[model samples]
Target: MRIALFFALILFHFSSISQSTDERAIREVLAQQVECWNEGDLECFMEGYWKSEQLVFIGSKGLTYGWQQTLDNYKKRYPDKSAMGILSFELIIVEPLSEDFWTVIGKWNLKLNSDNPNGHFSLIFRRLGDEWVIVSDHSS
Candidate 1:
């Protein structure tokens, strides 16, 4: 019984360590997206998402499916550097749903030239190989 308990503890410890590492990596991806958006690099910001037609994005405009469509929408909404403005994100929660999935809840703000648009968003991310990519996003 003691031997079995010892192995169980070891497994739990290693599982926690792996989850912690994954959490950090996920945060890094979000941080990079923020940097990209602030720099008015729409293309770079899109890199955080999965580049597949299966991807889904929900915004005030409506539901947009596919990676290319989402990128196009962003480009249309924010045409130039002035329109992109400074991007900021207030992350409320980053919860791990499973070993391979995470749900991120956050607020995003963009200080545009004429108006400031701020809203809350929830993103579903999936671990693919060595990286985590946003598979679905709901923002309003």
Candidate 2:
């Protein structure tokens, strides 16, 4: 009985460690995106997202599918640095849905020359291969 209990505790410890590592990785991806956005590099910002036709994004404009489509929409809306502005994010929740999936809820703010536009976002991240990438995003 003692041996069984010891093994269970070991398993729990490893599981928690894995989850912590995954959470840190997800946060790093968001940090990279913010840095890319602040630098006015839309392409670089998109590196945080999953580059696939299955990718989905929903915004004030409505539902958009595919990685290229999302990038196109961003370009259409924020054509210049003034429009893109400096981006910041406030994460409220980052919870794991399963071993390979996680959900993030956060507030995003853009500091522009004209005005600041802020909104909340919900993102679903999936572990694909060795990297965690945002597969779906809903922002308004």
Candidate 3:
């Protein structure tokens, strides 16, 4: 009976590890976003987002449609190094929406020489091709 129980525990542990592997992959994607932002690489940062025209990004100014529009907006709003100082994200929630989708809720903070701007953001990510990319983002 003890041996059977041990095997059951081992199986449970393996299942838990398997489940967490996906979460870890999602987190790695998130971490790459942070690293790219910190490095002041907007293009690299944009890699985390879906490249399709259907991708959406909502911000204080309003909603932006299309990946180019989103990139344009980012360039306009953070026009210089001073404005784009440093970007950091504090993940508040991360949950699997389905086998290939995830919902992420977090706070984004930017430190600038003039002022620090921070807001809450929620993003819907989907596993596309070989990586996870944001399909939709809403920030306030």
Which ranges of candidate 2 are over 4 A from the true structure? none
Candidate 1 lDDT over 1-140, as tens digits, reads 99999999999999999989988998999999999998889999999999999999998878999999999999998898888999889999998999899999999998887888899999999999999999999999
Best-matching candidate per TM-score = 2
Error of 3 at 26 (Å): 1.7
**RMSD each, Å:** 1.0, 0.7, 2.8
Candidates 1 and 2: which is better by TM-score?
Answer: 2
Model-by-model lDDT, in order?
0.93, 0.96, 0.87
Please give, for residues 11-96, the per-residue lDDT of candidate 2 as tens digits: 99999999999999999999999998988899999999999999999998789999999999999998977789999999999999
Best by lDDT: 2
Clash list (residue pairs), candidate 2: none
Better candidate by TM-score, 1 or 3: 1
- 114 in model 3: Cα distance from truth in Å? 1.3
Candidate 2 local lDDT, residue 78: 88
- For residue 139, give model 2's deviation from the true position in Å: 0.4
lDDT of 3 by residue, 1-140 (tens): 99999999999999678557767887888889888878877788898899999999988888888888999888997776566888889999988888788899999998888889899999998988768889999999
